[model samples]
Target chain A: MTEKTAITPATHTVPPAKFSHGVRKGDILQVAGQVGFLPAVEGQAPTVAGPTLREQTLQTLANVASVLQEGGASWDDVMMIRVYLTDTDHFAEMNEIYNAYFEEQGLKEAPAARTTVYVGLPKGLLVEIDALAVLG
Target chain B: MTEKTAITPATHTVPPAKFSHGVRKGDILQVAGQVGFLPAVEGQAPTVAGPTLREQTLQTLANVASVLQEGGASWDDVMMIRVYLTDTDHFAEMNEIYNAYFEEQGLKEAPAARTTVYVGLPKGLLVEIDALAVLG
Candidate 1:
């Protein structure tokens, strides 16, 4: 049996609850849903980056990447991704930012399978994302 | 390299878009988020099992189980699950139903690691769930 290990990067603030930033079992790592909130500094309330969906989407992906790296993986190792948006109207813009991120990472030809759905996010958050990666 | 294969069971209605119901990469099967809407009949608009959160949660789990089974898995094979609810007020009720389902399936000792978040589902939908299963 593969034991599950929690992965939390020192660079990231501790999550508010009991959940880890990511959990690794065998060769797989399942990351918790991440919003665009900036890393917590000791005594301040967490807040998302910019007010626009594009800005939040960027920060969210960056956060996901941080978690992936902490788990000893990379974007290339990600096999699937799920994007949650508060408004369907922002889907196209979110994808534009999303696609550019992968393209810049040199993974445009083999980007991971993705699913996007409109869902209400926490207050002030326009986007949230989580991912599954397979380590080679 | 492991190849990715899409799984779509005949018993389920085709999704509105291009994505598959589930995607298998090696031994890991990642199922797309499934809403509580009942399986489509020949000539009917899709509807959730009932208007209540409990009813919708049950049907959503069933739908997830069907997709998992079609991909050569069962609830026992599930390693992680994420639940999305439209209302945070329904958390306790959702967990009661969720826990009971696992108990009934004889998975009380080692239920899949789970994360629940508040998110709005499509209109008229109360819950949506997705899972990742590992096959031996």
Candidate 2:
């Protein structure tokens, strides 16, 4: 059996529950759903990036990227992403930001497949995103 | 380019939008979030298995497994599962059903890493489940 590893980036606090922020086994890496919360600050409660969907969306992507990088992967290795939005109205806005972000990253592989769903979130958060990456 | 294949089992309806039911690129297969709807029948709208969470949860797992099987992977190949439950009170109930189901499957690999979150689902549907599987 291949060894399994839990990944926690320096930017993240210990997850609130028993799960890792990300886990990699063999050639595949799975990032837990990540929200727009800013990187942990000493002695401060977790906070969202801002009130706007765009702000939270970018920060959530950054947070998911941090976990992927910590697991020795990158956006280019990502094969899929799942976005959770609290409100249905934010769908188009998220895609616009999502498209621009990946285009800027200039991924070498095909754009990762994605699924988005409307879901409830903790108070004040608008989006949550997670990723799956494969590496050679 | 490594080939990317979209997976749609005969049991499922064509997804409403551009998204595929599941997507496989190389060794990885991603099953899109699935709710408790029973397999579609001609001329009938999609419907949940039952009103009870246990009934819905079981059907939801079956639905996810159908896509995994379509991609030539099984529960044993699954590396991670993210479960979205509509009601917070149903977490323990869902876990009980989840544990019994997997235990009955008698998987060979370590139990897949799982993360659960509270989320909204379509009316009368209590859960949504998705899986990531890695094949040799």
TM-score of each: 0.63, 0.63
Candidate 1: Cα lDDT at B124: 80
TM-score of chain A of each: 0.93, 0.95
Off by over 4 Å in 1: A1-78, A88-125, A128-130, B42-45
Q: What residue pairs are clashing in model 1?
A: A120-B120
lDDT of every model, 2 decimals: 0.80, 0.82
Best-fitting candidate, scored by lDDT: 2
Calculate each model's fnat, 2 decimals.
0.11, 0.17
lDDT of 1 by residue, B1-136 (tens): 6756677777676664434688777887888888887888877767778998888889889988888988889988899898877788999999899888888877646778898877655678878888888889
Colliding pairs, model 2 = none
